[model samples]
Target: MAGGSFRKSLGYALAGLAYTLRTQPNMRFHFGAALVVVAVALLLGVGVRDLLIILFAIALVVIAEMFNTAVETVVDLYTAKYHPLARVAKDVAAGAVLLAALNSVVVGLLVFYPYLHAFVRFWARSWRGGN
Candidate 1:
């Protein structure tokens, strides 16, 4: 087919997502982490703009990981034997994932710090029998 129908295209895209979730451990971990982050943000009552920023950060990390997986898969398909160029390609992709993950961590900390601090202070006061 030159170009599939929109529904067919969506199906194919979903299949790829399923395949990635099924086959990639890192993807699963990212998904789990994303769920936790979202839950915590909601619990902390993060503002809409900050929540959106956190979501974007999470998406960036996941997208980077998916791209890294694609690069590794393609490199493996291209050469079974060790090659410097293939190694470089895989390493670069991994670096991108690392950077994205780091960015997400920074965003999470920045977004959640004040909320967490207040939560801790409130709990501490309760423990000390303070009003």
Candidate 2:
């Protein structure tokens, strides 16, 4: 951090992101889901408000994930050996991630249910050989 310029700060942040994506399987999954969400949003032409909510939910999950990664790394740095306090801290961080993931699920449902329902109905009609 000493002598770290603003450009170096950005580089360090990006490096952390790369490390998380490489080391955390869940982070990769979240990124994949994010891509799908963006694709679906574009295809459905969802309203601006709904899209904003979706984006916020996505960011929430990603933020929680990054925080979890940071917490775990710090805990390990504090002690490589097992300790009850370290376990508790890691568990709490993981819980935060789980809660964020669940929240995102609720957001996705609330924002996309109508569009999903319409797609289902369209499929049903097409299945019956009708427009």
Candidate 3:
């Protein structure tokens, strides 16, 4: 029973991912940004802790965008015409995504800035040493 339930949950999660990929432009952008972050972290030789932080931030932004998309879709389904409260609901959902994306940006900068700085400094020192 537990095994069956786990499989069902996994299937549902995959379906949700598929839906987002099919319908959401923002999801695509977030996914592309996530790939860039991962590549940057790898190039910078970020440690395990930094990688975890980066992953968490990426996940946070993606999840928030997914939730925002869901809310907007539901609102549109319920109302064919313009309504102030429906607009407010959609706006609030978008705001949530914006806030989460901002937080992710802060997290990425905080976690990676030192590594980036050190990389630049190392290159500068090596160039000077070579000269």
Candidate 4:
């Protein structure tokens, strides 16, 4: 890394990201979820602040997942046997992903609840023949 060209470093980073996307199902799922969330937010006309918060939450979850994958890969590389420490390392990494995912869910609910609530109310009124 030291003395490496900036472009070369960027290329390496991009290659790692591509490898992760190609190999990790969880990463793919996160990307798909992110796309859906962003599309919905746009359709709902979410305010800029809330949209930024949503994006941050999405990034946090994806970054945590990537870190978890890295930790698992390193642990597996270091030990093939079932060691207690390896188990602990993997579990801790997984817990990070879970926490990030939970945070994203909370953020999503907070940001989207108002829009969805109004939409549902309008839908109900229409169904009941109310203005």
Report the number of clashing residue pairs per model: 0, 0, 0, 0
- What does candidate 1's lDDT look like per residue over 9-118, in tens digits? 89987887888899999999999999999999999899999999999999999889888988999999999999999999999999999999999999999999999999
Tell me the deviation in Å of residue 128 in model 2: 3.8
Task: Rate residue 34 of model 1 by lDDT.
Answer: 98
Write down the worst ten-residue block by lDDT for model 4.
Answer: 1-10
After aligning candidate 1 to the native by TM-score, how far in Å is the CA of 81 from where it should be?
1.0
lDDT of each: 0.93, 0.94, 0.91, 0.94
Task: Give Cα distance to truth, residue 123, candidate 4, Å.
Answer: 2.8
Candidate that scores best on TM-score: 1
Count backbone overlaps in model 1.
0
Candidate 2, residues 13-100, lDDT tens digits: the string is 9999999999999999999999999899889988899999999999999999999999999999999999999999999999999999
Q: Candidate 1 local accuracy as lDDT?
A: 0.93
Cα lDDT for residue 44, candidate 3 = 91
Cα lDDT for residue 67, candidate 3: 88
Q: In lDDT terms, how accurate is model 3? A: 0.91
Ranking by TM-score: 1, 3, 4, 2
CA lDDT of 82 in candidate 1? Answer: 100
RMSD to truth, every model: 2.0, 2.7, 1.5, 2.2
